[model samples]
Target: MKNTILLLTLLFSVNAFADHSTSKFVWSGKCLNSNCTRSEIEAENKANYQKHLQHIQDLDAEQEEEDREWSRQHDEDQARADALPKYQYKPIPETDNCVTRFYEKASSIIGDNAKEYIDVEEIKSGKCIFGFKLMAEEMCEYFDSFSSMATPDWSEAEWCRYRSELREVYIQYSGLVGTSAFTDAVQAERKAKLKPVEDKHHKIYQNLYEQHLKQLKQ
Candidate 1:
């Protein structure tokens, strides 16, 4: 009887130990070891979130800087273009035939070869004269002739504005091409005022040419 009682006691003890072990895991879901801590997981997630936010902010800053730089460059380009000369045409009688003659003369000079380079400096000279002279004449013809035919309702202010604009264009390109002379004869006639103007524009044109040459060599 004592032996059977001892055996029954041993079995009860084993079952009680198993029930106690399983009872410890009752769905509380808390980590039961030193390997994983709630605080450590929270810290890791917060750090990752902060890092991602910083990365997004950096990208936004870069894009804003790029946009600002593009705006600055675009404004600078617009300013340079605005500084270029314009043209203004005036009313003149029977200027059509004279314009045609100028065109014929100027068109024959501008070329696409080594001669163009050689002639670039001499463009205002008789050898390079016709190209730009004709260009000016044709422009005047179209603006003046067309305006007279279709726009009798045009105001004096409008005409003046047109003439001023056209003159500016002529001056700018004349500066560019140095095409002020009709011929040596015409040059001699206007040498007093023409020379100083040409001299000034020539300096600017030469500087631009030198810069272009430097870029090409580079």
Candidate 2:
């Protein structure tokens, strides 16, 4: 009986030790598995965040470029509006006949039978078509006459006369561009705005002409 009791005690001790070792092993494995899963979740989260940041940066850059372009266009538009003189002029010219005559001249330049999209009768009679072409020609001819009277070495008196003629032409032209009758105040404003610009252009042209003349003589 004493031997049997000893054997039973030994057996119980071995079984308890085996059970403890197995439970420890399983707990270690569970801990390692949980750590691995957490690490994978963290890596995925980091990659997604990085991608979201990159996408936001790209969007910001695009918006910045769009803003810059809009600013540039707005500035250019504002400058143009500010530079243009504010003046009133009539919508149409004093005479439609002048428009007709100008068109005839332009037609002659291209050919007697000018290939126009619209017929002359349609224009001259103020028919249901776009505006007449004669107004453009008349303006051109008027400018031509004004240019002929002015010269590179013109005296102040000649300059004054030329300036006056150009002013009148500008007034009429402005009426065509804007919907208002040409008023004295508007004519004065146009003259002020155009005289310097026109003078500069004419000076450049005269200089080129003189250079050409000298080269020809040489």
Candidate 3:
């Protein structure tokens, strides 16, 4: 009877040990010290907290430096804008028959037989239409006689006169692009925006050029 009880106790102990050994282990990034003191843990947490604080401080300093740089750039950009001319569109010349003359000249370049799509190519060849940049450039120069006039070193009235002429030509381009269709959407957008963009750039350039002439005089 004693031997049977001892054998049962040994079997139960073995089973319990096997079950404990077979259980899965879970990792929790904890220091593998079951006997660690509370003071030791507190020391480690304090060190980690200090490192985190330092990292946050570093990030704040970096962000502050970036803000300073942007501010400097903003100031510089404002100065540059102030230096250039503030171009606003002028009304077309009110001379009698001015619009009539504009269309007449444009028609000669555009040809007598006009359509919704001005075969911009002037010369028709197969299905592809290449545009008439030369004619447009001539008209641009013609309309603004002061564009390349005397090295663009003109007085305020002269610049205003030039803008009036350019404005009229620009109006014609606006009408043409709006009314007519282009071979492609890209070409259409280009035609629409070209004159306006050029007008703005030329206005800025003219101001700088006038300043240059002043420097030469001084």
Write candidate 2's Cα lDDT for 1-218 as tens digits: 34345544654454323333223211122332343454554464455445645666666678789889999999999999999989989688545553355455545654553324212333334331222232233323333432332221222233344456666667656644555665677767777878776886578567767775887699
Alpha-carbon local distance difference test for all models: 0.44, 0.49, 0.47
Candidate 3, residues 56-169, lDDT tens digits: the string is: 666667878888999999999999999999999999874434233333444665454222212222122222222223223333333343222212222433444555566665
Candidate 2 residue 107 C-alpha distance from true site, Å: 34
The TM-scores, one per candidate, come to: 0.26, 0.26, 0.29
Regions of candidate 2 where Cα sits further than 4 Å from its true position: 1-36, 90-218
Model 1: how far residue 16 lies from native, Å:
43
Candidate 2 lDDT: 0.49
Best by TM-score: 3
Please list all clashing residue pairs in model 2, or write none if there are none. Answer: 89-180, 89-181, 90-180, 90-181, 90-182, 99-134
* lDDT-superior candidate, 1 or 3: 3
Number of clashes in model 3?
0
* RMSD value for candidate 2: 27.7
Cα-based RMSD of candidate 3: 27.5
Ranking by lDDT: 2, 3, 1
Tens digits of per-residue lDDT, candidate 1, 97-216, equal 433344433334332232222112222223222121212333333344323322212132233444455455456436434455456765454555555555655565566667758876
lDDT of 3 at 9: 60
